[model samples]
Target: MSTFHLKIIAYDKIFYDDEAASVVLPAIDGEVQILTNHEECVVALKTGEVRIGTPKGEMIPAVCGSGFAEVTSDNQVEILVDTIERPEEIDIRRAKEAKERAEERLLQHKSRMEYYRNTTSLARAMARLKEANKYRH
Candidate 1:
């Protein structure tokens, strides 16, 4: 099976670096799937889920904040994001608290900036919670 190197880096540290069979990224427009030898490209990523399929058939799921992705002709993919967290790394209690805070901010609805900020936070928290639940054993 063909595979390519995938490196995921967040603000604090490197999330992953390994060979993968396929990668599905959450782009601003939609989800984009990349395979080995995919054409070189750059894309802006949205805050959502990223699924990486390993050569051994393991699917690694992660929640990524808005960022960018670059694919090289040499079959190396680099993902740069503000934050990335695997399902197991997510703290459910923290996520719930964040969700509640965002909800409270939304209820206020004072300004557009505040509204969007809160909404984005809510979405991110929800995405993390969903991913964590999905992979929970």
Candidate 2:
């Protein structure tokens, strides 16, 4: 069976380290699935979900921040992200509060820099909320 070693590092933490049959990344262009022996390349990721396909065929979802990834020629993938949050690790209440704060900031008249900062924060909070709620049902 073909498999690849994957390591995801974010915010000074080892988010995930293991071997997987496949992994889907939220690249800037779109989602990209990497399989064993996938062509070596690098990509920029956005604020979205990173799906890992375990050997047991289970798909684990993780919310990740903007960053970049590199797939080595030896079938190893390394992803360096600004932040990462597992659905179970997210504090919904706190995320909601952050979302509210970001929304309020957006509503206020601000300089271009402030607006962009708030917008980024809002996007990050929303991404966390979305991942946390996905499995609620």
Candidate 3:
């Protein structure tokens, strides 16, 4: 299969940089798959799972926070997200605690911005937990 340059950058570090056969992203509208020579465009991402298909046919999975992806005309794909972590890297206990905190915050009610923030936090925590459990040994 053909491949393209895929670079995934989290706020703290570069999560991935190499040739990829494909990538399935959690776009705002829905899951978007990008293969080699995919159309040049940009898409908003939500807190969810990211599946990266490597040139060697391995599928690397990750959970990512909200952000965006840009596909350049040169067949290069770049994903910039607030956070990204592999299932093995996720701490289930920490994610569960974050979810509980977000739920508590939501129950208190606050400004619209605060509510939105809490909801996003909850979503990210849930995504992380789900991915981690799915791949748990």
Residues 22-134, model 2: lDDT tens digits: 99999999999999999999999999899999988998899999999999999899999999978999999999999999999999969999999998899989999999999
lDDT of 3 by residue, 12-123 (tens): 9999999999999999999999999999999999999999999999999999999999999899999999999999999889999999999999999999999999999999
Candidates arranged by TM-score, highest first: 3, 2, 1
> What tens-digit string does per-residue lDDT give for candidate 1 at 1-137?
89999999999999999999998999989999999999999999988999999999999999999999999999999999999999999999999999999999899969999899899899899999999999998
Q: Which candidate is the best by lDDT?
A: 3
**Which has the greatest TM-score?**
3
**Sort by lDDT, best first: what order?**
3, 1, 2
Each prediction's TM-score against the native?
Answer: 0.93, 0.94, 0.98
Off by over 4 Å in 1: none
Residue pairs clashing in model 3 are none
User: Which runs in model 3 stand beyond 4 Å of their true positions?
Assistant: none
TM-score of 3: 0.98
Tell me the deviation in Å of residue 91 in model 1: 1.2
Q: Say which prediction, candidate 2 or candidate 3, comes out ahead on lDDT.
A: 3
Better of 1 and 3 by lDDT: 3
